[model samples]
Target: MRINVLQHTPNEGPGSIQRWSQEHGHEMYIYHPYQFGNLPTSDQTDMLVILGGPMSPNDDLDWIEQERVLIRQLLADHKPIFGACYGAQQIAKTLGYAIKKAPHKEVGWAPVYLKSDIIPGIPEKLTALHWHEEMFEVPDQADLLFSSDLVKNQGFIMNGNVIGLQFHFEPEADNVREIAINDNQYPLEHNDLHQTGKEIIDHGVPTENKQVMYQLLDFMVKNS
Candidate 1:
């Protein structure tokens, strides 16, 4: 399988998702729209993955709009897509769902409760990394997958092909630390979002939660 990853920032790269792809011997291509030009055609992609970032979908960036159009087209064609954090918000906004600021920012390792009807392969409770101030309304055409206290629409699945996750299912301990340290400004500026590097790392990776990441990738590969 050839997966095309839409990376929005340098700090938040593919992380575990990239590892999964390599472990399975799948080719991975990256489209950094912030640095590159327009996105490539969907025909060149077997699966589309939109990674997390600090930028919001509502930002005034020209590439953001272009990427949204590309994602909408991919969804229209029934191509498989996996989005994380801001990537998930972009997926919602492109599908005509609302994205806005949440009541509080969720910026640490938090437990997410999987829906009873959740894809059947995921565990009930898993601690996942989160770092977003905005959340999205569940698209009318999608199924809610999981939820956290701070964000009700933590994840959703559309047409059995597009999966949007508000939390960092791809996070490894190092990735979490790097993200926290690199993007410390936002957390430091907002009282509701402050967390030390030790606190974030101490939350650690749950074995069951890490398995969920593989389950998600397996599902996408089989479905695709």
Candidate 2:
């Protein structure tokens, strides 16, 4: 199977998702829509993974809107899509859902409670890295998969193939460090859900986090 990733920035790479694709012997490719404008068409890949970024889907940018159009094309083609953080917000916006400012800027390692059994192997709650100020609403007709104290709409799944997560389940240790070094200033503010740069970087990516991410990837392929 061909799996392609829409990477918004250099820091927010596919991380564990790429590892999963490699281990599963699937063809994986990453595209930088922000830098190169080389967005993939629906027929080019079987599954699409949209990685996180600092930009918002609401921003008035050409590439951002282009990505939304590509997402709609993928949806029309019935291809599976997995979105993370900003990518999740993009998917929600594309689906006519609103992206609102979160009550709190959730940053660091926090637990998200599973709200549905759409995918197996996910525990009741798991600690995942988060670094988003904006949150996506659960799209119409989509199942709310996970929620957190800081954000009510943490994740959602639509049509059993499209999933969106407001947190980082794909980041490995080096990915965390890279994101921390670049996007570290946001969490400097004191908040209940916020963690310092050192804390976030030191926490690393947990084994269970990677396990659940792999489960989601598998579920995407199996259901797609």
- Top-TM-score structure, candidate number: 2
- Deviating ranges (above 4 Å) for candidate 2: 190-192
For all candidates in order, the CA lDDT equals 0.83, 0.89
Clashes by residue pair, model 1: none
Clashes of each: 0, 0
Give the Å error, residue 212, model 2.
0.3
Model 2 lDDT-worst window of ten: 186-195
After aligning candidate 1 to the native by TM-score, how far in Å is the CA of 39 from where it should be? 1.9
Tens-digit lDDT track for model 1 on 181-204? 787766555635466656776777
Candidate 2 structure quality by residue, lDDT tens digits, 52-140? 98889989999999889989999888899999999899999999989888988888999999999878768998999998889998988
Q: Report the error of model 2 at residue 84, Å.
A: 0.2
- lDDT winner among the candidates? 2
**lDDT, residue 73, model 1:** 79
